[model samples]
Target: MSRDDRQARRGYHHGNLKQALVDATLELVVERGPQGFTMAEAARKAGVSAGAPYRHFKGREEIIEEAARQGFEMFADLMEHAYASAPPSALARFEATGRAYLAFARKFPGHYITMFESGLPIAQNSDLKRTTDRAFAVLTRAAEELIARMPKDKRPPASMVSNHIWAMSHGVVELFSRGQPGTKTPFAPEDLLESGIGIYLRGLGLIERDD
Candidate 1:
């Protein structure tokens, strides 16, 4: 066994050490963006020795990457719950998912930024790719349901619609919801998303009467 493993075994709270390290990493990400600290710093923050993080993570990159993975998993759950709680209308459900996306970004700024802005190569990280795909699948499923309710001739391709909505929602969050520097819009992020999506759907002849 490695020396780090030996030390971990000797520790009183070995079982919870991984979670403690993750928690500490998140605190650091919040204080100083995702790239702000080193693995040793995260270990120190977690109250472990300099070499302790290696017991759970390969290095600093892996630590943040794992955090991003967890973020995506939580994000998927939020989207699923939002869709499930919405009214019967497909449009309503789709809107709810969009709102959930924005809400997640607002509530979990550290996770949101790391998930999107961390610059991690998703293709190289199987776990990250899988979790991200699951989160995206929620949006795609919602789009498919919405398109199904439309007239056969009016329905756009589900994939195209899903991508469009995802792009718009992401743009809105990146520009307005996160309080980032961008065009100063008087409308709230949710309001902006609602209005923009409403217009886009109308333009596509997807919905006529706004119920």
Candidate 2:
């Protein structure tokens, strides 16, 4: 190959090497907190020379931010899948989406924590912001559908109903992630979430309210 071609290939390799390094560092973040993570360790895990990460990332924080971006991208994908996989009914889809979100947080606590942290530079990424909104948009559509299906006599405004359901589900999942309805309690996480959503539906009069 020509010298210029070889140089371009080397640059591309360096870019990919840095991405792999950040990916490895995120895995470590799951096991070890961010404060305890290091660039050299990430390089070792990525199978690159110890100094290679410096070619792309300035420091440990830079790698963490990139990893956080990747995490949000995955989060958006999970939300999309949950919404797409639910049954025909809007309410059924809403519940499924809520459960899926909680499952994601429980399964990937590290990424969940990073993605939601306001101080993280990853939150500023345009793609992360866009993906985050797309995920919420899925929830919004489910809310609109549910509101549409409500009995003509009692249906709430779509905007109001959407906001209510979204808030209700997000609150339950966020609290559960913080360890609410602890294992010491009789109810499983799923049980608590199901019960909470039922109560919310009853309040909205979407389900028959027992007097």
- lDDT of model 1 at position 204: 80
Which pairs of residues clash in candidate 1, taking residues 3 or more apart in a chain or in different chains? Answer: none
Q: Report the C-alpha lDDT of model 2 over 1-211, residue by residue, as the tens digit.
A: 7544454455456567767776677677767777766777877667665676788889887777776777777877887798888887777888887787778778776676666642575346786677677777777777777777578788766667556655665565566555545745565667777787788888876777767
Instruction: Give candidate 1 misplaced runs (Cα > 4 Å).
Output: 1-15, 150-154, 179-184, 209-211
Model 2 error, position 24 (Å): 2.0
Error of 1 at 32 (Å): 2.0
Give me the runs in candidate 2 sitting further than 4 Å from their true place.
1-16, 121-123, 149-184
Q: What does candidate 1's lDDT look like per residue over 83-190, in tens digits?
A: 889999889988998899889988988788778878999889999999988888888888899888778887888888878888888999878876553457778888
In model 2, the worst 10-residue window by lDDT is 3-12
